[model samples]
Target: MGASLNEIKSKIASTAKTSQITGAMQMVSAAKLQKSENHAKKYQTYASKVKQVTLDLVSHDKGPSKNPMMLKREVKKTGYLVITSDRGLVGGYNANILKSVMSELMKKKNDDAFSVMALGGMGADFFKARDIKVSYELRGLSDQPNFEEVRHIVSEAVKLYQSEEFDELFVCYNHHVNSLTSEVRMEKMLPISFDDVTSTPSLDTFELEPDRDQILDQLLPQYAESLIYGSIVDAKTAEHAAGMTAMQTATDNANSVIHDLTIQFNRARQAAITQEITEIVAGAAAL
Candidate 1:
């Protein structure tokens, strides 16, 4: 009885320690999630406004101006930019993105060359270990990433597109649906399409300051860069939400284990007391 009680007590102690750690982690993740969500929400307005301006500029053109980024060519080579987290413990956040991308990649043949831009340690290491072609790797991104942090990577990706390194460019990241839900989304960044925007040209037209071609040459790259930065901002928010949920689940499981262990310990203690009382009564009867 004593041994059983002691064992249950130890289990209770271990479970309690785990609960404390998980609870702390949950709190930390919740705080980060709040900040990340705020940042994402604010940036979303900017991203939408920028998209609207670009759409109006492209759609309202009076001349036959074609942006290089909007041109669609035969798919010869592809560039895949995958965003993941630097650390684990965020449930299936990283796994879902990797798996979704892998499923798509598996459809292609070995001969088709695809360059990978891995943004985060998990993503970089995952592709590297699989012997995949990782062209550029960006790790150690902040929980709430700033545009400056993402600028170089975005510039290089655009440069690769401009140099014809990849005929098509796709970026994959976790899109934040809500605090509790996120979805993996793969969007084509190159060959910018205005499919989502209305094709109807704005009735009011403004004169181009320098000419349509020059404006597109500068504006197209900024639009492409904004796409990457906006995605990263949303992905960071999703990452924090996932982390908070994972840690909360962990804490809840630990608490359940502690509760069960506490009940077992009480039972064992009661049995020990009953055994000692019975022994005393038996000795008295024998005397």
Candidate 2:
């Protein structure tokens, strides 16, 4: 019993150390979550402004004028852009979003309706393992992503859309509402919707130095990139928030485990001491 008590004490100590590590990680993730959340909100504003400007310029009643992204093509194939975290340990953060996207795909008319361009390893591997077609895969992005890193992927997706290769495009990601809550969101990227238009004041309404039509031809693609970039930022915010919460829960669980183990250790030690006293008293009585 003495030996068992010591062993259990050692386990408790090890668990305590692990809990400390997780606690530190929780703090770090909390700080990151704050920054990411702010950035996501700011980017959304910029994206919204861009969308509104584009919509106002292209607000013709007839429809979009020869815009590839706005054109509705026959569905030869579709693309799913799965945005998930590269690493795990964020509770149901990745799983919930992935499952939502998979369930959505399962409901599509064609059994194998879409290919994926995965932004993270988990979703990439998930699609590959399932023999779902994958057009591209990019991973190892930082906690706070900059738009430059993912330009290649965005360009490729845009090119594919322009070439009439993919009739539709979707980005499946988790949107950060707050630290404690997030929602798995699916955004349609191609065949741009009227709702994409926003109400922003900063976009110059009277600046006609470069002519709206020519400027729009160039601005539309950049605006599309902004949407992708904004989504990535939003997804990252959710990831950090989820990670912080998960780590805090892990720390709490570890502390609870240590509490139980310490109680067991104390009982074992007391039992061992009692046994020693009992043996000595018995020996004296026997003498």
Candidate 3:
């Protein structure tokens, strides 16, 4: 009885330690999630303004000054810039995004039909393990990523599209709907179409400095880079939220286990005490 009680006590201690670790992780992830959310929100304003100005220029132009990014061509090869977290313990976060990419890849008739640009270590390793070609890869992004960190990869993707390496490019990631819910999303990034731009009624007009075409030549690429950067910010937010929720669940489960073990320990101790009392009473009667 003593041995059993001691075992239950040990289990309770171990479970409580686990609960503490997970609880700490949960708090850290929550803090990161808040920071990521704020960064993403602030970035959206700049991204929207850039898109608006780029589209406005496109709309007002009457000439045949069609930017190459805006023109659509035959899509012989496609590119996927997949975003995933470098670390694990984010419940189903990496799995769902990878699954979504696989589902899209399964649609291709040929193995060489598409290539991938992985933005995180998880995605980079995943694609490489399958012998899939990963043209560009980056890892170890901060919890709240900055645009400069991702600019090089974004520029490379846009350049590849322009070079006709892939006629179209898509970015895949998990979209944060709430703290507890996220959904996988694939967004087209290349062959920029005016139709894809969100339309807003604006009475504002801008006086051109150099020329509309020249400004577009610079603005269009920046706009595409901004799109990629914005997606990365959003994906990071989702990753943090997923991590926070997963840690919270783990802590809860550990605490539940601890509770059960504590109850068992109490019952065993009580049983031992009762047995000792009965033994003493029997001795007294015999005397």
Candidate number with greatest TM-score: 1
| Per-prediction tally of clashes | 0, 0, 0
Q: Residue 52 of model 1: what lDDT?
A: 76
Question: Which candidate wins on lDDT?
Answer: 3
| Backbone clash pairs in model 3 (N, Cα, C under 3 Å; residues 3+ apart or in different chains), count | 0
Candidate lDDT (C-alpha), each: 0.87, 0.84, 0.89
Model 3 agreement with the true structure over 122-213: per-residue lDDT tens digits: 99999899888899999989888787789889999999998889989999999888889998989998888777556653524656788878
Models 1 onward score TM values of 0.95, 0.91, 0.94
Q: Candidate 1: misplaced stretches above 4 Å? A: 62-64, 199-203
Q: What is the C-alpha lDDT profile of model 2 across 35-132, one tens digit per residue?
A: 88778777778886787777776663334557666667888777888999899889899999989988987877874677679998988888888877
Question: Per-residue alpha-carbon lDDT of model 1 for 100-217, expressed as tens digits?
Answer: 9998888778735678899999999998899887899999998888999989999999999988999888999999998789999999999788767565565245777777678788
Model 2: lDDT to the true structure:
0.84
> What's the CA RMSD for each of the models?
1.5, 2.5, 1.9
Model 1 scores a C-alpha lDDT of 0.87
Q: Over all chains combined, what TM-score does candidate 2 have?
A: 0.91
Query: How much is 9 displaced in model 2, in angstroms?
Result: 0.7
Better of 1 and 2 by TM-score: 1
